[model samples]
Target: MTAVPQERRIVTAIPGPKSQELQARRLSTVAGGVGSVLPVFTARAGGGIIEDIDGNRMIDFGSGIAVTSVGASAEAVVRRASAQLADFTHTCFMVTPYEGYVEVCEALAELTPGDHAKKSALFNSGAEAVENAVKIARSYTKRQAVVVFDHGYHGRTNLTMALTSKNMPYKQGFGPFAPEVYRVPVAYGYRWPTGAENCGPEAAAQAIDQISKQIGAENVAAIIIEPVLGEGGFIEPAKGFLPAIVKFANDNGIVFVADEIQSGFCRTGQWFACEDEGIVPDLITTAKGIAGGLPLAAVTGRAEMMDSVHGGGLGGTYGGNPVACAGALGSIETMKELDLNAAAKKIESIMKTRLTAMQEKYDIIGDIRGRGAMIAIELVKDPVSKTPFPEAAGALAKACHAEGVLVLTCGTYGNVLRFLPPIVIGEDLLNEGLDVIEAAFAGI
Candidate 1:
């Protein structure tokens, strides 16, 4: 087999010759509401590089927003998906079910961390998985209220919009959101209002207390949270917060739901982020990287909790499409064979070393934090004051892109630069991308 190239190849401007033509066509044919992060239209992708329509190749650090942990086009995933296509495509899992679905579910049940019996239900998107998990919690607990944390992003669905904390794009004109949903403060250490150096546990306790007093835990269906807040700036909760919340939920009859959509499948150097705390949630919602670029999301949890909703209530028209299931199976196989968990750790090691050096060199870098491959660098006008610099972050990102490196900016204030490189990325390519980031900051 031939080895893959690591560094980026920029033949023309970002939206290169062919991509410019496609962009014009896309404006005419595709919906105007559809947004794009980068202008380069991808013609091919493999390992960790995306080949643009005009022959410009770039190292893909976003992994399609953490959806391709195995790689862009892992050989095993393509082979399995192609083989499954030869057999069948969509039987509409609800109408006629298939073995691939059951097999995938079985794998989920086995892989999900728990010695207790578990079950899984598949869906088409992370939003769908989150919504279904809420439904299951409400059905199982017979409660009317759902509690979510501030800066948490569940999805774009009505219920998930209610769960999400951001307001500008996801919820601008989409409301009225689903009813009986409440928002609480997340344990963000850097910019917390409490002013404690490490106030995650204290903040979580306060939020739990407030909810208990207002909503009454007995009437609360579930408390949904992302183990590591993804779109809200890759904020990982302080050490004691997760365990405290899990204990509170278990004791108070609230379903502890872990939205691992962005942090699962070894993205955080573990199967799930909750595993870092040794906490097993009642319901775990996952997607993004599960199917190696295919759209497949799942809610796996304690058997009793997962089975609470009646059989017909938990499915979608194309929930567990066979092709997606095959892709998922292949993805899981690739993770194991490639030892992605170890790879994630390696990514973290490299990122921490490089980012820490950058922080020392740049006063704009306020904080450097994250687990494994899921890392972020927060930007601020003054490191000591920690005032977010949204414009600086955006400028830095554009500068990196102009230099042929594709990077992403996130956080509620849009002041954090996150790195979600494919676990299969080569060390040299990863370092090169990091160098571009350093150069961008240096120029700024």
Candidate 2:
């Protein structure tokens, strides 16, 4: 493995000769449905930089889609996972239990929002955690309908695709989706039909009203939403919207599930995004940043609700794999020692300052939203019309990449430039990356 210096050094063009050759091979072998944001093949990534095969280094604004909050190959995670790998790769927890899996669950219970008694079940990905959360919610509540908000993304499975609000590459031609899934209004401050000031109360009321009249609250199993929407742009639900919905769920006996996969584990300046707002969810699904880039996710919730599932119903063969569990434990230890929450807040401050300055200059930046290190700028044709400018977003991302800064663009309308820098990224490197973005904006 390369000991990549945590600095951007574009010695060659981004997808330099070596990567260009591999790109051609990838197109031939990899499926078309699976897409990549950056074309260059990564040699090593850590801290704030991704070193490509050709030795070109680029600042990592996307933390492997927010999976590596403690930095992609943090010493703790690698050390622990390596030890576990050498000991025994997998006995399968269902077949033979391991301490690491239980330990990961313990961390989840202690760390996830709500002071109530909580239990957790681990899985291989965010989607599995989400899908299992649905199963548990339905089992406990004996309800059929699952409600998700507009501009929210749950996962890619048939069921999650239904819960997810976006269409395009995610849901298009993938249905007939799982039934009993209802879509409601999200308090998207930027493009809310009702306007930003009224988005919170109005959207919450409409969502609650729709459930009451159409789905009937009694029929609802869960209301799953991302605290700060990811993939459908980084749309944070306006203040009061989440609390209102949680209240509705409480009144109706519907499970309040927060999909915190992208916003959990100190990525949002708190252990979890919901904690900042004091919005306690009955169930929370986590992945992404949970294990310092390992493929592990968990559904942590109230003890009784999680216990509702039959003994063998909630797990998969690789659920809480010993090595992943080790990684997660190590990841958690790193988070505590590093106080990555404070780092996340600092990232937010830097981003807020730079992006706010950019907004002052650029008419294309319609709105800036998100919390902690998970920030985004919604590009629009102009602030007046607020029409999505997906093309401009693409151009800006391209320019940043060429300048040795890896910026990611996402959104419902493909108009959001989301930055998920590692919490450990240094201030100097961070500012340098921002300079690239600012220059990109100036050129575009």
Candidate 3:
């Protein structure tokens, strides 16, 4: 049912002549800070393939940084959004209420973890949802300090920049951030100083100690974390880490916020990554894959915490646009019909098998971690020293791009190669993409 062919076919060089021209124009008009991992200009995308204007068909391993889980231009998503477009585009959900907006919130209430009576507020992006979750937590607990983890990426907004730990690109020169934000260590098993086995409890104890000694638990309004850290390199906290943190937050009066913006909506083989540990957050922030590529986000949480905010205190002009809500409904329908959660787990099984083989063959691969479709490999200069090999990551990605496979890189050290293939991708196309990566690794 997808219009684009699910195959990788290189007609010209990666950036072909047309893409080069577009890149030149883009540099002239776009801001300097904006960056592109692969510069091939896309003409159409569906299933698992991105067709460039130059007639090159490329396998989409990045999924537009995990935004197109249901695939770009899914039939149901396009159909529903088009029907909504025919009805109306925008009336500002705040000024004129609509059923679509309310329906999305209803879906979030049902889908998000937890059986307690829940409520949801819509937003236009993940950053807005996260910021609002912080506000709601503060209003509920009447506390000012917030705790975030090292290597976590919230967003580019000022406060989210504060929540984000990386410095070079996201937080460089953008200082004077919001006040009272605190950072703590996460349970990164591979890089844990002591050892991988001891990471779970040790990191949790260290984090709690820092909050108690440095900032005082009662003063903290919220403790936010990505169940599976995305931009900070697909790092899933070790076992016992999340439960311990959740217990600590409950013990203290801090609202626990799970930033599921990247790892939510079946991206991690589960409905949400927090469900892997059966951890229920007080407030859950979601976006990215919510509306089949439309700009829609949400903050769903306990009824009491959400209602704590004053009326009209949480809304935006374009939040929960009617068309986006339609897209979200259609997306959810597609996910259910296709059983993308099962597909994501299948992807994990295949990728782990292939990547594990590649790791055994190559010494540069230091670690293989992540769940379901959101998987990554950390490159290192040496296995024993474990020094990050960011250059190798960059090289491997570039090679994959040249061969018509779109790959992405991340990590605080810039040494992680992440693959987020569309959950609906064909098995043949998925294997072909991995083949490209294996070939690239061999060459590098």
Candidate 4:
């Protein structure tokens, strides 16, 4: 197979003739609700490049929303998944158990934090895994309430939309959402009223206080949070915040669920982000990077909690499709073989060095945060005021896209420009992408 060259080659204007034609066709056939960051349509993608239908190769900095960390066309993933697909595409685990499903669960049990005996249930999407985690937590604790944090993103399903913090794109017009879901404050350092240093302890105290007075701890089944928030702009809660919340959950017998869907599987320089704070959650939800772009997700937690749900209580027809399980196993293998964790750390070091330098030069860049390859720059109207400058972010992204660099903008205020470059990306390509970003900022 011809691998996609790790080079940026802009042969046509962003959405070139072919891509424009496809976009026109897509507008007529695809749902209006589905949005894309760039106007160009992809023809092939591999390594750190996405080749558009018009033959323009752009540097990939989004990783398909961090789902293709092991690379879109990892050799191991392709080999294993292809082999499994050739053998058989489906044999629903619920119908006739398969080794691949059991193997994936075993991997989750071993890889996820905590030494205690663990169990996992597979699903088809991040939202599904989160929904099931809540089910298990509620069943185990016999509670009716769940607590989440501000600026946290879980997923798009009804229950997840309720769990998610943003409104316009994710939760708008989707209510009435699931009941008994409460949102509390997060240790958002940049915008915290008290300042970044005090954000951790104060935010945790306030969040726990709200739970105690507003929603009785005894009634709360789970407190789910992204160790490093994803669509909520990759906000890693202030230090000590997660630990304090974990302690409160332990004290109250509530399940502490770390939703590591976006920050897990070595994306943050470690197998999981919670490990950075030495947090061992009672339950954890994972997806995205787990299956090398295949549709797979999982909820892994303490054995007793997972076993609390009665048999036949949880499952779906295509939950752990054998092919997806194979892909996940292969993805894990590739992660280990390539030592992608170290690669992610290197990317983090390079990005921080460059972004911090950019922050100094640009009054619009208010903050630079995130870990490993999952880094971001929050744009502001001006550093002195620190007012969110979403318009600047939009213009910057468009300029980069026009120059053959693919980036993504997120955050509740839509002012954060996030980068999730594949760990396998070469130093030269990574720096080139950053140069494009820097040039865009200069124009601002």
Clashing pairs counted in every model: 0, 0, 0, 0
Q: Where is model 2 more than 4 Å wrong at Cα?
A: none
- Once superposed on the true structure, which residue ranges of model 4 sit more than 4 Å away at CA? none
Against the hidden reference, what TM-scores do the models get? 0.98, 0.98, 0.99, 0.99
* Candidate 1: worst-modelled 10 consecutive residues by lDDT: 1-10
- For candidate 2, write residues 1-444 as lDDT tens digits: 445598889889877999999999999999988999888999888888888899899899999999988888899999999999999999999999999999988888888877899999989999999999999999999988999888888899999988888888888998898998899888887777868889899989988998899989999999999999999899888889889999999998999999999999898899999886699999999999999998999999999999998889989899999999999999999999999999999999999999999999999999988889999999999899999999999999999989999989889999999999999999999999999899998897
lDDT for each residue of candidate 4 in 1-444, tens digit (9 for 90 to 100): 689999999998998999999999999999999999987988899889999999999999999999999889999999999999999999888889989999999999989998999999999999999999999999999998999999999989999999999998998887999999999999999999979999999999999999999999989999999999999888989999999999999999999999999999999999999999999999999999999999999999999999999999999999999999999999999999999999999999999999999988888889999999999999999887889999998999999999999999999999999999988889999999999999998987
* Candidate 4: residue 11 Cα off by (Å): 0.3
Per-residue error (Å), model 1, residue 110: 1.4
TM-score of candidate 2 on Cα atoms, chains taken together: 0.98
lDDT values, one for every candidate = 0.89, 0.91, 0.95, 0.94
Error of 4 at 224 (Å): 0.4
Query: Number of clashes in model 4?
Result: 0
- lDDT at residue 391 of model 1 (Cα atoms): 97
What ranking of all candidate models by lDDT puts the best one first? Answer: 3, 4, 2, 1
Question: Of the candidates numbered 2 and 4, which has the greater TM-score value?
Answer: 4
Top candidate when judged by lDDT against the true structure: 3
Model 4 per-residue lDDT at 146: 97
